[model samples]
Target: MPGERLTQQERQRIATGLAGGLSYAEIARRLDRPTSTISREIGRNGGPRGYRPQQAHQATVQRARRETPASARAAGAPLGAAGEEIVELAVRTGLPRMTARVHVDLLLSEDGRRTAAELTRRLRVSPASVSVAVNYLVQYGYARRERDPRRRRDVYVVDDDALYHSVMLSTRHTLESARAAMAAAEASGADSPVGRRLAKSGAFLERVSLEMMESADRWRALLA
Candidate 1:
């Protein structure tokens, strides 16, 4: 309902339309779909000389399969834990899965640095996706942005100090939030199984966070 699907018949019509010197808008109007939709479909499937209905249909099917629900995909080949986490985080943050994937790739790079345009070119994705990915990384403390005087756009870096700083900040915030949650649970006499589990997690988080802060301080001093 969002966009009229281009079927084999439509593909043939597209070929015929081209021979008749019909514009994309004219073809779209006849096909009852948006001009942009038709443009993208044709552009991706083969564009002008290479367009083939069966090939386009197969490509569409494959793309759909890749994006289908995990359950609907092959059994026992479930998305691994990291993949699942990325999907969940993308959903919660309203970011696309591809953005998370690109950011993660940049973060895991040996140099931990890349310019926005460089990332777009490397990933072969739209500039919008690159922008969203970089923003998400900055938001989560996994990456930091720095502008080069010579460059028009910002460069994202995954420096050790920046990463440590982000982790420490996030860990501290999590500890504080968990403490508050623990207090609320106790005040409500929620010491049942769920409450007890949550309280234990809070204590663990507080202790771990303090240790991490100490480690970060030591590392910073050593760097200095």
Candidate 2:
């Protein structure tokens, strides 16, 4: 559903929806499509003000005809084998694909830092995409942003305690899950067989997470 092409009828409906001042999400809901599909269609097809469904459809046809070479085009410079592997691992750890790539790029940088523009140029993606990815990294405590006085630009720097923060994040989730399980156990009558199993599992997870947090804080203090 996500990757499917928009039908001509859908394009016409999108045009009508846009004319009716409907939001992308609303239009997407009407069409049973992802909001991103609507946004991208409008963005690439002369934007909201100039979007012409027929022209856009024709353009899509032409683009598809020319896509073989475009698909084979290298995504700028390769991130190197190790960097690529790390990016994949980061994605597996729940980071979004673009966010993981940006994080890995920062991690592989000389000083674990890069500006939004630098990221855009290196990643060969739009500035908005870089902004979103870096914002996510900063939000998760994986990185921080600082102003470069001379350049008058913000630079994203991977946190020196990123690993420690990562451990804490993992522990926090485990602890929360344990609490949820315990709550469910209580609701189901803790003396019941299933409730007892839930309680035991919850207790184990809770204890282990607390121990990990304590050890991590001690290690962090030692490193400091």
Candidate 3:
């Protein structure tokens, strides 16, 4: 069922299931499909609130037709091991696979900028899917959105300081958590075993935050 396409009947069933307030997992169980399939189907079309079976079915068909040739071409031009490793690293650093793949694709592109349509054709994904991935990239500071003056389409530009921003965000979160932990430890009395453990954790996180800041400064200096 790896490459299975949902039938119109199945789409109707999914719409009905959503109307009846069934969870995605329950709907998937009824259809003998994976929950991710159900989730993707719903996500691609209007979500649970606005999903329409007929519309969803038609959209799916159109997407399949559009992507068929592109997918075939992509298969012939595989991303080498290095590209795959970049995607894997992004995933390990907390990006979803699709988002990470999109990020890496942008990073590898010659100009580091692409329109949604271009990304859709290159990645063999729907415009909606590319939009979702690009939105994620933009939100996390990995990419920026700009309007093309000559065209109506929006373009996504990869940020050169993407990794630095991501690390800085993480470092700030760690420092905040450490501060909260220290406050909790103090409130619980410093003599208690739980308080001592919390203090240790907070100290470690603080050190990590400091080290991250120092590293970021060094990298920024090199860039300058």
Candidate 4:
């Protein structure tokens, strides 16, 4: 409906289309939204070259928060549509739905950290659910757990390094898989045709993974 707000995904499409030199009408047509809505969104956020999807989405969230009443904030504000879109995007990247929600909430938090109790309060889930999701995040290096002695609780922390940590973890897993493939090939008779194919594929993966790690190290400072 025209009264509904634009989703984070719609904003992403607008950014992509704008970057690709698409006209407002074209972008609107693709989104099945009004051309005026597209025009107003870009105008308010940043025109053409200055537009960015993530920033635009965050701005929308900020606007909603600002509009919410202070009295209403005592119980915690809704995460908002933009925030939910962020959770959905995280889930699309292979995180389970609840884990993605917990992680994204931490990412969006003003302090980049939250206790299990705080998560349960805002997420409207049981403490046990928050504990399981947070454990998954901490175990996979997607987040860090810190003791908040002053608060007498553990806080789950997310930071810029969260993504970098996840990438490195995934690369490590790929390297292990490559080594396992080579081992399997040897056990299947190293002289066989299938064994040769497996060895070749494994060697390629191992080489690429090593090079990627080296390059990642060399350019790691860029993330800072």
Candidate 5:
């Protein structure tokens, strides 16, 4: 199992562990979490030179709050208070708290992209969490993984093309599926309101799909 969240006792243990000159792996073994997790938790909040449990916890809360939704971001609330408020809003809005945070963080980024290391530093989260967020955003079409030509690692990027390409592809798939369903319904002679509605929907889907496809192709050609 993943480790339980660090409590005050655990925080004290971490400080003691460090003072005792135990390696991160040793500390993690005692804490029942991955070494990388411990390393990131410490690295983000403060290093061995100056790690304070209360301060680390507060810093994590602040990082979480900074990535909350736009409305919350605009409120200029205190970190701890804002994080709690955002969680309440997340429950009401059906937003997966961490997922929303990741998306909002990406949206707020000036360059629309950040490396995993950069995110780890910013969010005070484990690298695993950062990886999960990046993957979620990429899979949901809200972000894209772009290979850095000069480097081995890929960065998650949000861009107009990411949204446009996702929408266009989805539209094309919907059009094709609609066409197939329409043909089958027509052949079955089940010309009820449902069938008629299906046909009409297919027509609309096809028309919009074609327009989007043509526009996308033109844009691609221009860029090429």
Candidate 6:
């Protein structure tokens, strides 16, 4: 069931269900499929508002035709040992293989700027697959989109500052959550273990936030 492709009729039903204001779970239940399957189907085709059953089916067909066998592609253009090692390390660090591959490819690019089409060609993956990988990178701060001056297409950029920005963003959220947790724990009972734990956690998070800022500044100076 995991790899089963959605039929055109199923996609039609999904479109109809969306038009009727049905939730993804409800649609999935009606289709006797997983909610994630329904969600992914809609997401990849077009989000709820833009989904068109016939167009989606056609797109899927085109994508299937365009996708080359991974093994064959690998044999044709194998990555260097260093690149493969980086991809493996990224996978070990919790990234999905495709996402990690895309990230590492961007990181290894000399200019740190690559078009989606270039990424698709270099990675030997379908355009749709590359789009997903690029979206993941953008969402996680591992990459960014910039308009190419010479072309209408956007360029995906991976640079040193991306990691710094990601860290700072995470640090802000952690500090905010820790403060909220401390407040909640105090409301329950400041003398309790929960309160003490929250207090310590918040203090640690505060220190981490400060250290992160200092490190970012030092890195900026070095870069400058």
Report the lDDT tens digits of candidate 4 across residue range 118-211: 8999888788878878887886678999998898889899987777787677677567656655765676668887567667867987898888
Scored by TM-score, the top model is 2
Colliding pairs, model 4: none
TM-score of 4: 0.61
**Candidate 1 lDDT (Cα, whole model)?**
0.63
Clashing pairs in 6: none
How would the candidate models be sorted by lDDT, starting from the highest?
Answer: 2, 4, 3, 6, 1, 5
Error of 1 at 170 (Å): 3.6
User: For model 5, what is the alpha-carbon lDDT of residue 133?
Assistant: 65
Name the lDDT of candidate 6.
0.72
Ranking by TM-score: 2, 4, 3, 6, 1, 5
Give residue 81's lDDT in candidate 2 (0 to 100). 73
Q: Find the 10 residues in a row with the least total lDDT in model 5.
A: 1-10
**Residue-wise lDDT of candidate 5 within 77-131, one digit each (tens)?**
3224545465446333333445545655665678988888877676666798778
lDDT of 3 by residue, 1-224 (tens): 23346755467667656754569998898777999999999998999999997888778766754665755435423345677688656544445556766787788889899888887887777787777788867865778899998998799988667767766766775676566566667766788886787678678878988998998978775543
Write candidate 2's Cα lDDT for 59-169 as tens digits.
775675366354333562457778768865664444555777788888889988899998988888899888878876775577888999999999999867887886787
What ranges in model 2 sit over 4 Å off? 1-76, 221-224
Model 3 clash pairs are none
Off by over 4 Å in 5: 1-100, 124-129, 147-152, 187-193, 215-224
Q: For every model shown, what is its TM-score relative to the native structure?
A: 0.48, 0.63, 0.60, 0.61, 0.44, 0.59
Of 3 and 5, the candidate ranking higher by TM-score: 3
Off by over 4 Å in 3: 1-78
| lDDT for 199 (candidate 1) | 65
lDDT of 5: 0.63
- Per-residue error for 177 in candidate 1, Å, reads 3.6
Clashes of each: 0, 0, 0, 0, 0, 0
